[model samples]
Structures are given as structure tokens and as C-alpha cells.
Target: MEGHKLGRAPNFTGACIVMFGVNLGWILLLLFAVYGLVAAIFLGLVVNHWVSWLEHRKQLADQRYGDVSGDT
Candidate 1:
């Protein structure tokens, strides 16, 4: 009955080194919060496939320059 007596200030080997440093800092902050949520869902699917490839290259340059209506 002599396990470094536990009756005063946290003494069972300092409460097992503060419960193994708080369970290794909560398992390294839960693996860096699941790698920052899988890098924010692959950076929002690469910025929504680069804004849908720049709106399909501005509708193929307004069908090769013929749209702003000045009667072609």
C-alpha cells in the first residue's frame, strides 16, 4: 500500500503527467481538425473549376466577336 501516496496535490506521478499531457493535446488537435477539413474541400473544388473555365472563355469570345449588337 505505498504507491507514492495520493492525498495532497496531484501526486500519483503528477496524475500520470497530467493524463499524458491531456491525451497528447487531444491527439494533435484531432489531426489538425482533419487536415483543415480536407483543405477546405480541395479549395472548393479548385474554385469551382476556375469559375467554370471563365464562363467557357466568355462564350468563346462572344462567338468570335459578334454580339454587343452594333449590327455586327
Candidate 2:
């Protein structure tokens, strides 16, 4: 009976390792997805800010020099 139980140890260890690996993979994938979404949102905000600043600068220029296109 002792020998039979010892023989099963390796199989149990292998199953445990496989389960751990699968769980780790899912956890890592979830973290990466969340981080990527946050990054995308941050990038969008930065772009919006730059666009707003540029528009403000254009307005200032137009005010100082008048419309160069003479469109009125």
C-alpha cells in the first residue's frame, strides 16, 4: 500500500502544476487587457487636449491678424 501511494504522488503534483499554470495565464491576460484599455483612454485624452490647444492658438492668431482668407 505504501508503494502504491507513492506512485500516485507524481501524478498529483503534475495535475496541480497544470492547474496553477492555467489560472496564472488567465490572470495575466485579464491584467493586460485592463492595462491596455487604460492606456488607450489616456492616449485619447492627451490627443483631445492637444487638439483643443491648437484650436485655441488658431483663434488667437485669427484675432491678432484678422482672417487672412478675407472670408469675413
Candidate 3:
């Protein structure tokens, strides 16, 4: 098929570079989101453990000192 040239053919090198950049950007963004999600979950677990430990210590203290106060 004899086709007339449209203005100018698109540059293959430029297209490839643009696509590579876009894919790299998306990959980086996805990695960052996953890292943040994992970090948040880890921090939440740590906080929960810390709170439980504090509660346990408080209970132990009260159990030991409760006999001395006659304020039942």
C-alpha cells in the first residue's frame, strides 16, 4: 500500500525512553506504598504488645499491694 507520509514519523527512541520512565515511576510508587503498609502494620503490632505488657504489669502490682490496703 502506497501511503503518504503524515507529517513526521514518531521517534522510536523517544517513545521507548518515555515508556521506560513511566514504568519505572510506577514501580517505585508501588514499592513505597507496600513498604509503608508493612511499616504501619509492624508499628501497630508493637504498640499493641506494649499496651498489653503495661496492663499486665499494672495487674501484677495491684495483686501484690491489694492485701495491704483493707479498702475492699
Candidate 4:
């Protein structure tokens, strides 16, 4: 049998730091995804409400003043 050569153990601190960095990267990515989804939903809702409000205002204006279109 060949004699086994002993080697120094790997650096535990470096390994731990690398693992922590990987985990932190994943966590940050997940948080950003959630934040983006929420922001998109909020923006969509605001735009929807704004469009509806504008339509309502236009309707009210039309009712108050007959179609000003000279085509009449």
C-alpha cells in the first residue's frame, strides 16, 4: 500500500465567507424581484385609476357641453 501524504486542511474562514457571499447574493436577488413585482403592480393600479378618472372627467365635460365638433 502506498503511504498517504498528509496535506494542510482547507481554509475554513475563506469557505465560510464564500458561502455567506453566495447566500447574500441570492437573498438580495429575491428581495429585488419581490420589490420590482410590487412596484409594477402599484404602478399599474395607479395608471388604471388615472385613466378611469380622466375618462370620467371627459364624460362630465361632454355632458356639460354638447359635442363642440363643428361636424354637427
Q: Tens digit of lDDT per residue, candidate 1, span 1-72?
A: 767777766448778869976975675567557777566566556766987999798778889985775444
- Residue 64 accuracy (lDDT) in model 2: 98
Model 3: per-residue Cα lDDT at residue 10: 70
At residue 69, candidate 4 shows an lDDT of: 54
Order of candidates by TM-score, top first?
2, 4, 3, 1
lDDT of 2 at 15: 85
Model 2, residue 66: C-alpha shift (Å):
0.3
lDDT of 2 by residue, 1-72 (tens): 656544333347678869976975675567568787666566556766987999899889999998896646
Better candidate by TM-score, 3 or 4: 4
**Model-by-model lDDT, in order?**
0.71, 0.72, 0.71, 0.73
Q: Which stretches of candidate 1 lie over 4 Å from their true place?
A: 1-37, 48-52, 69-72
Q: Each model's number of backbone clashes?
A: 0, 0, 0, 0
lDDT, candidate 2, residue 12?
A: 79
Candidate 1, after superposition: displacement of residue 7 in Å? 84
Residue ranges of candidate 2 with Cα displaced over 4 Å: 1-35, 70-72
Clashes of 3: 0
Per-model TM against the reference: 0.26, 0.48, 0.44, 0.47
Name the 10 consecutive residues with the lowest summed lDDT in model 3: 63-72
RMSD each, Å: 25.8, 25.8, 26.7, 26.2
The lDDT of model 3 is: 0.71
In candidate 2, list every pair of residues with a backbone clash: none
